[model samples]
Target chain A: MLVIEDLHVKVGDREVLKGLNLEIKSGETFILFGPNGSGKTSLLMTLMGFSGYKVVKGKIIFKGKDITNLPVYERARMGIGMSFQRPPTIHGLKTRDLVQMCAKYAQNKEIDVLNLAKKVNFLDFLDRDINSGFSGGEIKRSELLQLMAQQPDLLLFDEPESGVDLENMALIGKIVKNLLRGNGESPRPDVPMKELKKIRQVSGLIITHTGYILDYVNADRGQVLMNGQLCCEGRPRDILEHISKFGYKECVRCLNK
Target chain B: MSEQIKIDRFKLEGMEVEQDLQQFVSKYKEELEMAGIVVNELERSGTYLHLNQNPLQCKSHQSGLEILDIKDALSKYDGLPDYYWKAVDKNKDEYTKLAASKVHGGYFIRVSKNVKIKDPVQSCLFIKDENVGQSVHNIVVVEEGAEVHIITGCATSHKVKSALHLGISEFFLKKGAKLTFTMVHNWGEQVEVRPRTVGILEQDAVFQSNYILLKPVKIVQSFPVVYLNGSGAVARFNSILVATPGSYINSGNKIVLNAPNTRGEIISRAITTGGEIIAPGVIEANNVPAKGHLECKGLILNDGVIHAIPELKGTRSGVELSHEAAVGKIAQEEIEYLMARGLDEDEATSTIVRGFMNVDIMGLPLKLKQAIDKIIAETEKDMF
Candidate 1:
């Protein structure tokens, strides 16, 4: 479960996230949509406990506990995971090392190195530095790998569909659905086997920018975040189609009203 | 403290095993062969690396590293090259040696005029002793228009008391010739290390070298000098060292550019955690068309540690020489961030330390750089 109550954020003198409030229960998939620099990343980074963003007023309750002031890594330790919009390319740390570290932190389990790599086509890059020279799609998939390894209770994804190709997008959607549906088994990727059958293990709060995820994923609810505030709530497709036709002009009109 | 400033140092009897030297040479040979370079029994030319007449040699478009060394290549040379020699010197002219174990510890390497070799020649100097002495005299000469790479690594295998290494390297880079020398020092605890090195660059020639010192020693006094004597000659010196816990390393590099359109760079990074490190490096360009730079960085990991006294002296303003020095410590925020991510304090510290020392040994051979990293890491664990 995830809850945000009257969140107020500011970068320098300008207020970004203005008293935003939202809630999502366990097993519920929610999509947050916003225009460029419309405080989308600011909201996500604040939730991730990033520095430089002052959470002036807000209460973020995850799993029935208030964690509005926890550190990024602390949040990550307590079953809260995030995939950065622009992930850091930490050199000298192999991809597998990072995944293992995440797994140990989130689940206290040592992930099978080879099995983890085979997921999302990163077997050849297991020993490579995390995103050191990865392509866009590769970076997204690697982030997905880390998320899978973390197996957190609440996962916040920042623009997962921005940098991936169509095939990778489909794969990410299928993986998320499978993981959420309780299919937490690494069914030897080479040969067909029984799909991981567990359901509703993770509740995902994802950010979709271009209606790309709507084409592949069916979310429970959709929220429009703008100018540091939640401007509207509607179906994911309805919000996507409105944004496509009006290009945030309708949001501006509603804000003025 | 003894009044002996240790202006002169050399081991009377070395403890290095013969097999160690053979292993280093063998590795060097394998890499050379893979590059299509043939290392025969010194041949009549007395040149260990025959880049010109050897035919595998070609003119490089730019100056950087090319290949890392393979293992066990020196054994193929048949008991070292005939021309390799080592000696100690006062300043650039006088020689002094109270004792020496191997009068000839390394093979002599030379390049002829207008003949250039692409692959670098590597030498390993392992100081194996406890309360003993060792000395080596390495002589290198670069004739006009010739090029070469010289890499040397020094370490001790056994615990030793009162050890010393007095080495003098005299290099003559002739007209338009080039030479790059990389030296990594892994001296042991309770050891005294003193090295005297110099390079003389002639017209249009360039001489560049890098020195990396790992772990800590009671006392270390080594400064390599480069003197530009010909028109358009160049020289560069890069040194990195770490000192912690009662260790004091007084080391730096110096370059004198006296020619027109000549260039040189001197960069050094030193980290002191518990002891003191005094580094005052200088780069002096004495005439027109000369350009040089000097940078010295020091990081302090713990309190009660002296990371002070890092200075850079740049002279000859019209010659385009700039020098700077800095001292810092690891931030608490950085540590806390990493620790929150499930890594313990020690693991995070080691990770940061290892990351800090990943010098871009780009032009150096990959295997050679990896070997150096491993040695540095090993020494770092001991220091901690």
Candidate 2:
């Protein structure tokens, strides 16, 4: 669903992502394990077309279109969605209004905002200003709520479990799993597993430092990013085990080799 | 005070409403509606309509409520010995002096003790003749344990381009009383407006004031002050202002907490396209266990100017006072955050601006709220 070739990104005077190449096929969930300052967020931001993350040399192909230089809103309209790690607090813009805006381009069925908000337990905050004085878990749920409304083909998440508590983590994890699996709310108990797997089309690219998301999402592949480069590629669970056992120092060595 | 107006340039009399009341209401309904006044009085508790120096209508439909012209009230109450010019000083400025010298016509509303009026009392001060100078004096008194709301709209007729409006208003809230006063202004492009206002609150009284001005004018300036005299009294002020090209507006509010357990807050939002705006707010706490806060926010869209000054003072050992002031363009981060939600830049910008000038907290009437929203939409076009 998304392809990046020789993506070299510069934030200010320093280059964050140097000659990076990655690709995720349709219905695939790719887990990225990276240390701090390893350019995980920079990559997500570059793909979303945020300003200040200048692309010195890159070509971002999304759904067969070259979107490397597209404006942020155009990219968002073209089925690219991102959940911000630290979103801005927009005073006076109600959360309910924003959710409705996200669902403005829905194709066929009408979106019931109240019902969607109930899934995220955010009904009480619908009239409040977006992201104003929200706790960490509330921010995550708010982001997930908007993403569900957008129903984008490709989803990008930056540390879904950073500030969430244990109880909220379980709730957020289940919602994220449902969103990535292309099943909203209920997964159709009558449909066979094989048929459901074949029909899934949503793609996800998640960045994680603690690997807590693995317990919820059945990711197909994983990679370790160290010093602006990706080196290790293997099963998602195996990579998590290796990193937890030896830390990122072993990944640095593997990159050098 | 820098640019002085020649008071002699405007005629003080002879701009009366000669038509029938019903005919006049139908003729100027559009302009009057823009200022938050409804011509139909079915849903209103009382209405006082003033045309230049003439008192066209003064009547009350609800019991325990009194509505009369200032002249009639003065004669009936012996010049309203306890209310007239009591809260506000008559010699404070040249505009006050003019209003005190020749009181054209204004409203005198009173709520009887322990009476709770549900519908708002509406007043309109309209100018319909060019080069006409209109002066008025308004007085409102809420008796002990009473509750009421007053909405005053000031506007100039569409054909009247150049005029002068000078208004003086005073409010008094007795013990355990509650009052909400909302004022909306829609003046002509060449009109000059000067208003002087003050309020006094007794023990356990609550007062809220909302002011909205969203049209162009030559020059307008006002600074209204409120005093919390007894313990447990509270006061709040909220204002929304906008200035278009060639317009100049200077306005603010001040509150003083003089008794223990009193609280005061002042909040204002201003936007300027090509005109100039000066907004200042002040809150002072003088007694123990008193608290006050002042906030002023301004947004300068294009080549315009906005100056926000917020101040707070605490004179007692246990008083708490604070202030927050910001003046600049809309933050780039806030704009991009909206863009990421699939809205284009223009849509995102207007949405942010609308939120910045939000009136949801004011609890305004539905019709008045819709009128303000329309004005905001029209103002956004000029901003872009």
Candidate 3:
């Protein structure tokens, strides 16, 4: 669903991502594990088309369309969605209004906004400004609520486990699991597993620092991004275990071979 | 009135608003209709009056509320109390002099002692004659233990290009009385408005004032003062102003705390697109055990310039006075944050502007708050 080839990105004068190559097919969930300052957020932001992250050399192909140079909103329209690490508080724009805006391009325009808000336990805050005075977990859940409303083809999450507590993490994990499946509704349990997977299949590139999200999201593959390059790929759990045991330096040492 | 006369008299002290008198009146009538200004007798429980440089019509249903023209009020009471008369005497300006010399239209409101007025008294004041100055001398007296709310709207039509509006308002609150005053102004691009307002609160009395201006005007300069003279008296001033292109707006308030334990707060929010706005505020604590706070926020939408100067003075060591003032463009991050939520750049900016102007003022009556909110929303929609 998304292709990033030979991507070289620069934030200001410093190069953050150099020659990064990545791709995610439809109905696939990819987990990116990285240490601090390892260019995990840069890739997500570049894909989301934030103006500050400039692409020097590379092509971002989304659904076979070149969107490397598109503005942020246009990228959003092209079905590319991102959950910011620190979303700024907008004073006048109500949360309900924002969710409605996200649903503008959805095939089902008449999405039940309050019900979506209720799933994230944000119904009371629907009338408030976006991210205004929200705690870290509240902000994350609010972002997730917008994504559910958007129902985008590709979802980019920046560090879903960081700063989230146990309770919030469980809720976020469940939501992320449903999001990957492309539906947030409770499974009838009577439905067959294959049919559910087909209904829930969505492409997602998620950044996890604690790897706590692995317990919730059934990620198909895992990749490690270190120093602006992809150095390893394997099962998400195995890659996470390898990093936990040896640290990212061991990956660099193995790459030297 | 066919000929335009550049009369040297009543030229206003600082700004100018004058065109042809007949044409101004005609244009004003059209604007009055649009503003829903009823000129005929308004007989209802709550008083609703219209003023066109004079008290054109007045209807009072409640026996406790006495609405009268300035002349009738003066003659009926034999004369106003020396305290309120002195309040008007304090403003020594050319416009005040013009208003005193030839008072055209103004209201006298008196709430009887211990009477609680539930329904608000509404008034509409408009200016029609360019050559004919529209000067009003208004007085509001709430007796001891009384409660009342007053809503006054001042406006001018499109064709009434130029005209001068000078308003001299004085309010008095007796012991244990409460008064809430709300004023809305919509003036033409060439209109010059100079309003002199003052309020005196007695012991344990409360006074709240709300002012909103959204339309364009050539010039508007106002600095109303309130004196918390009695112990435990409270005063609050809330204002929202939008100065459109080519307009010069200077608005502020000054509150003096005289009695121990008196409290005051002044909050002003201003938005300037391409106009020049100067928001100045002053709060002086003259006695120990008094507290006052001043906050001014200005939003410059385009190339407009805004100057926010807040001055706080404390006389006694036990008094506490503080102020905060800021002037800047809307944060780009805020705009982009909204845009990321699927709004275009313009929609995002407008939403932020609407939010910036949404400064919550406590104790607003639900009806008045809803009206103000609707007006603010409409203004935001029209602005962008």
Task: Put down candidate 2 lDDT per residue, A117-236, tens digits, no spaces.
Answer: 999999999999999999999999999999988887788999999999999989899998988877453556899776777775889999988888889987999998777888799898
- Residues B1-384, model 2: lDDT tens digits: 364788899998776657477877898999888888878875688999998889999989989999999999999999999999999998888888888999988999999999999988899999988999999999999999999989899999899899999999999999999999999999999899999999999999999999999889889999999999989999999999999999899999999999999999999999998898889898888897999988899999987889888888888798999888999999888888777878899999999999999999889988889888988888788888
Better of 1 and 2 by DockQ: 2
Off-target runs (Cα >4 Å) in candidate 3 are A185-194, A198-200, A254-257, B1-45, B48-50, B359-384
Best by lDDT: 2
On TM-score, the leading prediction is 2
Give the least accurate 10-residue stretch of model 1 chain B, judged by summed lDDT. Answer: B50-59
Tell me the tens digit of each residue's lDDT in model 1 across B270-338: 777676677767777777777877777677777424433433344556667676766776554444434
lDDT for predicted candidate 2 compared with the true structure: 0.90
lDDT of 3 by residue, B157-188 (tens): 55667877788999999999999887878888
Residue A225 displacement in candidate 3 (angstroms):
2.4
TM-score, one value per model = 0.64, 0.97, 0.89
Ranking by TM-score: 2, 3, 1
What local lDDT does model 3 show for residue B96? 77
